[model samples]
Target chain A: MSAAELHNNEMIHGYLNDLRRYLSRLAPHETQEVIREIESHLFDVLDQQAANGQAADVAEILRGFGDARQLAALYVAHIEEGAPPPRGFRAIQSVKKSVTASLYFAMAVFGFSMAFGLLFIAGAKFLLPESVGVWSTPHGDSIVVGFVSVPPMATPEVMGWWIVPVATLLAVGVAWLTRKVLLVLKQHM
Target chain B: MNSTEALMEKWEVQLRKGTLELAILAALQQRTLYGLELLKLLQSLPSTTITEGTLYPLLDRLKRDELVDAQWVQEGETRPRKYYQLTPLGNKKLTDLTRLWRQSVSDIEWLLANPGPQPLPNTGV
Candidate 1:
């Protein structure tokens, strides 16, 4: 429509506001610019409609552009393309994110393994008597074997008490080393 | 029409969105202008359009490519505004695009004039 004949300024303002609110929540810094672009696009469409004698109210005509979800997606794409991180920063960020995820996954595995070990100790204590005794290896090293609070003793099937502290320390040591290895891997990758 | 068809049409319109960037660049080639001025010129076009926000990013891309140059100018009682002008590279590209565009127009016109049977022969020329 000709500038002289335009009459829907207030309606256009509101329409732009609605679109702006939807876009702003998706991308804060660039929302105003996005609103301006959508306004210009809507204006062009309204201008064409006016020329065609189909719509007298450009603002009213634009009130129908829906799909808040799609609009949000568009804002995301716009920000992605327009404000991408530097390649170096992106590489570092991705590595950090992956390593952090792997750490959590490994922690879960450690927790489950510890739980199983405790269960085995509990089951052995419940089924077997505390009458076993400590034994000596060929190296003249003495080893103690028993469940929690039971006297040091040996059984052919049950793991030794020494094994408990050793395995716990070893598991902890491996996890700590793995964390360092992950840090090094991230640094190199 | 079904809602799916309406969505498809919207997607179709979005795919045609590249023309807006092309049109904006073409308009900026005519004169050095700030964001609002360039948007105004594009809105004045018969078959092209652009938004205020869209121009900034497109201009940023063009600037990054060294296709356009921008400078901030301060006026007495207003905040400085950035104005953009086509760079030498941009001018060179615009010339190339103009040639290709005009050639396409003429090619389409020739096709319209000489209605062919079945499709134009496989002129591998």
Candidate 2:
């Protein structure tokens, strides 16, 4: 064979190899069938050119097939469309989507409510300083937080004016964390 | 390309895409042709010209849809070629599409023949 023919064969094989790689999603036999058909078509075109006394132009022929990846994509697209999803596959996908959506809402509710409660406590501390205080029982067996009808007897209040800043900071941190988490969940949804 | 040329090209692409299946079905009417022959036949026509990338995939789809049947035919000493022919369903589709195509052409022709400043006939309004 001539050097030009050898080079043409190499180029044809190279293009077919790339096409085969891109068609991996197809079944093995189907991939082979696609490859075989294309190879046959290529050779037929070359034979026609030879019969017409024209040189084999592998590049021009490959151009008609366009990019290997794009051609494979077209074949894959139709196969996917032809085969409907398995029974209940769509149901599972929807369930997963809803689960993410519900998780997002649940996280939003839990986080925002916690932040709101903290901010409320901070506000209440200023309005009813005497009613709301954190106290340790006499034996330190238990600690009590939030409003009380009357201040605990003989137990000193902790976080005396600093509770406002502490509660506000905690609220801000929880709110920020909630926002970030919701953003992540939203993407999945 | 100039904007006008670009717009014309886009319109042509849309027109080609819309009619491609009909064209393929019509081409295969009472005829069995392999990929290369079919591609050559289509490229010979002005509007039905398409690439190997487009033709093979579309043929695959037509086969899958039962609109066409393909078989690998091997002649003496030559490579096997997958030849395609219209199935009954494909022929039915071609007939239906031909009717619609004729209807569309006549409608456009009527509109062209009847210019503005004259009310279209057969309109109750």
Candidate 3:
């Protein structure tokens, strides 16, 4: 490539990197879309300037784009108008956004895992007969593992059939929690 | 620049910002142009001062609002160019906005031409 072409390429690359960092919250596809449009526009401008025998100063070209963050904000505002509003200061908002999203995801994954385990236990308890015992010993003591069952140490009160409905509700709660976690993941993605 | 000139410059910026959407719509009234082509045409005009950052978002807004239609067309060997044109709804909007803008400009011009009442010559009561 010619010196001018190399310089132009460097300038465009630098400007795009600045823009990408500023718009980090955007989905990969969205960021690419914006960058592609910009690259096309800049190259056309530069080519025209070159043809006219004028110097296509990269700094001048970038200035024409205005401030990088401001430009990113404009695109973000336009695209994410339907999404949640960014909070606090401009720079802080991006950091807070990613941090918050990651925290929510982590919490959701933890919640879902806990819920799944609990739901499995509850479901197993519901399926097992009330009198069923995990370990029946010759000493006339039975070890119970049911959701509502008292361990061998605790007072052995017979759990009523109503435990089925209660266990069912707990399973339903876990399912709902799973759905919510999936939604949060989808939105972040 | 002096303070008065600076103040005028500030207001001009504000005024231009407001009219840019209208200007873009007007430009697209007759023909379809790709992003760079449209930018060139607007830059050629003395009144319009726009950059890709401002123009693309506005174009995106217009597209989102269903005021403009866009398509990618490729002629052999070159990159596909995205061209934008006005939708039927956009035409209607442009016609209405143009009328309102013209009326407002005329009113402002009248106020400028005749600076009304010149302090109403000291009516001593």
Candidate 4:
């Protein structure tokens, strides 16, 4: 009703808004429950202050709750990490684990095979220079690359010695990317 | 604060953190209090004092752990307050923690009471 009371209400609302934003990670109902409890506590404290003939110092009360972000973080940490998983959550957790595991192995297999394929081509170019070559068709309609026992009849070989360095670079790049991906996946697992 | 006072404050914080759960459980024994009421009761004590920031989240955790139960109660025109009480599990926890606390206090008191003029007494060792 008073100007001061209006300002205090604004401050409380502002604090609660910030708290709600920080607590967005919680389920909607859980977030509302936390907000409601704190709101109730804040108003109760104000009433107590009024009953005692003391002016409502919203700042002092908010200080007891500390920063809204910090308070929300405490709630989030306990709810997310401290509480045990609910029933049927174990199945979901296992499924998640398996998915990560499959992704990791699949990535390793795909990436390493590609890398090894490139490396093999690069190496074979030295041993069988005639067989392993990048070739352009007579009509230049398509290009073929990789190890071939008979180099493709009448297709002029291109990239000569350049294929070795190019393939080697590609192999290194693929291997590095795979390692980075696996590292990220390992953390989730 | 000066270094000595800061050190003392740090020690007090550690002490409070260790005893906080037990203190909460003990406070709720045979009582149902809302957040503000519980906070006031805790602040009334010198050592068990805690802020709203600490209490609410800890209470949430206790409820999640099934150690405490909370209910929203409306009285007349006042806002509905979430009242908390110790569950059976919470009471059992309180009993266990109280025994541990008393034992710790007695052990420390024994050490403090006995000054080293003679060898420390050994019983059944």
Candidate 5:
């Protein structure tokens, strides 16, 4: 169906948003220039289509132009580098995107792992009997430090042996994941 | 398609991309035209199949490179339209590109007509 017939303003807005976001890497003025020209061209095409009594869907025409990101890449590449701009940069960009996604996934997995690991230890200490718990004693509950479980009744020597190193490793991992998540967010934003 | 056909398709796209600017310059050589008029003119040509997708970016690039200049002109009750005309630099560039294109065409035509020799004739060895 024709975008004009459908009067799909939301789809148009979403398309423009994607184009704008894709073009955001260009210098502000350059980005604005490309977008303005594109907008004007799109309007002219639509007007011509309407004048011809043919309801050519604006969305379909935009789709014919291909993906907004790809169009933006072509615009930016040609504008910046002149005619016959080198291709394959989009492949590189996609790889970068995948890496960023991997970082997010890794961060989420690590964050959930740490949180659930700690919660499971706490849960086991409270729910399970002291005799059956990983290291809980009859006196009190157990606390998790990295891979080790430390009961309140444990010896100071055992605590000193595992707690410091395990805690340090877990803290470093959490900190690293947090930093990675922030870095990825910063890049996207 | 096979690898060679795919390669030809890729080259065809590249060739088209290279020629579009020349075609736009050639179109603007005569007089000023608005985006829609220019688009219509190009569409009318048997050699050009460009839609708005390729047109605007090319126009913007031409304007950026100082090959063409644009102005907003209002006519009657209609909205203002950006009209484009070639600059002196664009004219000179167009001439050079046209000369090169003609030479390439001539060279290719000659090559087509005289494609060297057949391999070993009808030798069954």
Candidate 6:
């Protein structure tokens, strides 16, 4: 019989969740995936040992891996130096920070864009129908173009694409600046 | 154990501490074992014990670095266990570290064996 048969699936689920949460400080982006890999490696080894009739304690097994402080310190040193992440993990932390900033910026831009879109739609509906057709000062032709009943202010073309990229870049800059400020202030803290 | 040995256990972690990573890696080079098994093996050596929180993280770092490879296997009808083993790189690192450590020990021993502290006291009134 294997470990799955001995314990409920929920136990493993909970255990894996706990492991991910515990490792979050170090590998926030790939925490769960990293934990799963480690967990799989551990279970395989433990199972073999158990096959030899040796009793095992999961927590102790986990603990024997060694001190996280020293390990985290090494990673943090790389981060501060702006060096690549250690061998297995990539140094995508700065990327994540940039993306997170961009997301927030996008949300802000989205709210303003939506307001602009709505105002354009409403302005088109209200102002276009108030007059039969917009008359140009130089032409004698008042070319009847609208049904007046439907409003002719064709919605102002939304420049969502422009907003998205601009917002994202602005957000990334802000996030980068914020991180620098925090790092500078850490000594005082 | 002698009286000095007993005293050393309490205060010696500070003294023999810089090479702990070397110590742990050397221990792991012996076999592929899970966290607890590694801990037990390290402890079973007679005079040392390492905390669990500290050990596991270091192991994860090692695994992440590809210095070690780990796998999970079902132990019983109940739960799976994780085990670690040295990669070729890890073995090489262990071997190099061992030689360096041995050299340092010899160098330090040689230094300690030959020491002269004869300085005349300066008296200025």
lDDT score, candidate 2: 0.90
lDDT of each: 0.60, 0.90, 0.76, 0.93, 0.70, 0.58
C-alpha TM-scores of all predictions:
0.43, 0.66, 0.61, 0.67, 0.54, 0.43
| lDDT by residue for model 6 (A35-140), tens | 6555654575567667988775565555544344443453344345555554345446667667666665565566555445434433453444443333222343
Q: Candidate 2: where is the Cα deviation over 4 Å? A: A79-189
Tell me, by DockQ, which candidate is best.
Answer: 4
Best by lDDT: 4
Candidate 6 per-residue C-alpha lDDT over B1-125 given as tens digits, one digit per residue, 9 for 90 to 100: 99899898757776445666677788877687877677777667654466554566567667766789877766667456677889998888889989998999898996677565743234221
- Worst 10-residue lDDT window, candidate 1 chain B: B46-55
Q: What is the lDDT of residue A9 in candidate 5?
A: 53
lDDT of 4 by residue, B12-92 (tens): 999999999999999999999999989999999999999999999999989988999999999999999999999999999
lDDT of 1 at B100: 77
Clashes of 6: 30
lDDT string for model 2 (B32-98, tens) is 9999989999999999999998999899889878999999999999889999999999999999999
DockQ scores of all models, one per candidate: 0.08, 0.57, 0.50, 0.62, 0.28, 0.26
Model 5 over residues B1-125: C-alpha lDDT tens digits?
99999998888778877888888999998799988788889889866658776787678778868999998787997666789999999999999999999999997896676554654334522
State candidate 4's TM-score: 0.67
Q: Mind giving the per-residue lDDT tens digits that candidate 3 earns over B10-80?
A: 99889889999999999999799998888888989978868877888789778868999888788897676
Instruction: State the DockQ, from 0 to 1, for candidate 1.
Output: 0.08
Global fold similarity of model 2 (TM-score):
0.66
Q: Higher lDDT: candidate 1 or 4?
A: 4
Model 5, which residues run further than 4 Å from truth? A1-6, A26-30, A78-189, B1-8, B115-125
Q: Whose lDDT is higher: candidate 2's or candidate 6's?
A: 2
Candidate 2 local Cα displacement, residue B26, angstroms: 0.3
Error of 6 at A158 (Å): 44
The superposed Cα distance between candidate 1 and the true structure at residue A154, in angstroms, equals: 6.1
Say which prediction, candidate 3 or candidate 5, comes out ahead on lDDT: 3
Q: Score residue A167 of candidate 1 by CA lDDT.
A: 52
Residue-wise C-alpha lDDT for candidate 1, range A97-128, written one tens digit per residue:
88777776676576556555544544454365
